[model samples]
Target: MSLNYPAEGRNYIMDAAIHGGQQIGTWYVALYEGDYTPQEDDTAANIGARATEITAYTELTRPELVESAATGGASDNTGNLAQFTLSAPKTVRGFAVVSSAGKGTNTGKLLAYQRLATPRAYAAGDVVKVPVSLILSNPA
Candidate 1:
């Protein structure tokens, strides 16, 4: 299924597929982010947002089918390394693996992967390393 999300200055679309299976559950969700055309200053400008959706209860396939359509990256280290500062230490349950870029002068091009946090303690300026690059369903 497809859905549209409203944003202040951007457009967003989300797609999801629920696999119809047995006891357990599986779903694949993809989000699209983009900006409307034209800018108030008569210049070419755009904005984008990420999209996420909940899977329906009637899905009957593997979420991979849907994820395949969405943006995805392979599992590899040294792909995209990012640094973020946490205002306060919090338990990172999950994260949306968006696009990733590295900052090292000699860093190689790497895919970005978002995953749960490790050790559970994150101080300010703690860096997060995502290994795979998520599908560019959304363009910012």
Candidate 2:
């Protein structure tokens, strides 16, 4: 998974992928801490012993660096499954971010995670809710 937080921005962009390590889960499950994956890079491990050492140093344990908030006004993805960086880092198997309406017609409405979901409203102090449990992946 990768998160793209543009500099000088107030909205954070996030992306995540599932490998072969994730377990089956139900809906509406929230992932907590202590489920992070701490594995070294695969390529580094294949390049002999010395390369493995270097790769270990460059390994990324958590996906926090990818989360960022855009500035000059926030970005909104209303009625859609928007990708927002997780401020509290944890490498789970699977997760999703849900948002409640900030104002206007969508105020206080429950938005499900679907393609129809879009970031329609962007604002400061907006709440980002991660309502799924994250599966921790093992090292390759």
Candidate 3:
């Protein structure tokens, strides 16, 4: 099962096994700052929307599997156990599973944005481990 998501000013396809789409291999992931409404201009280089991104994400460059395909999702979302140790105050509303690592000046494809079940508000020295998952099915 494949779904088309907006990425790099075009539609990027994903095999959403949950939505009857075929499953694929590894994909990159990133944590976007809360209130970051995804836009066409978003790239691997910028976590836009005046939203402050948390760079403490340990697996910023890891290619992980789609943890479990949801039965009615629009795309295949690979879930990962992300742990964050914040050195300053922060609030994270959601995350993004991208097609490539936005390291250096190269921006990759933006797969989808998964909002936290509950927004997390953290203070200095706070440690939070999030089970961030992806939903590529049921396009909005």
Q: Tell me the lDDT of model 1 at 4.
A: 18
Sorted by lDDT, highest first, which candidate order results? 3, 1, 2
Query: Clash number for every model?
Result: 16, 27, 10
TM-score of each: 0.27, 0.16, 0.55
lDDT digits (tens) for residues 1-140 of candidate 1: 11112231121111112343222122222111122222222110111122211111122321121122232522222333322434444343222222212111112111121233332444445543323233334555
Better of 1 and 2 by lDDT: 1
Runs in model 2 lying further than 4 Å from the true structure: 1-116, 133-140
Q: Against the correct fold, how does model 2 do in TM-score? A: 0.16
Q: Pick the candidate with the highest TM-score.
A: 3
User: lDDT by residue for model 3 over 1-140, one digit each (tens)?
Assistant: 12223464234443353355544355654555666555655654564333445665434443343455556642343344545566667787766565555432235555655556567787877765545444443335
- Which candidate wins on lDDT? 3
Residue pairs in steric clash, candidate 3? 1-21, 1-22, 66-78, 73-137, 73-138, 74-136, 74-137, 74-138, 75-136, 75-137
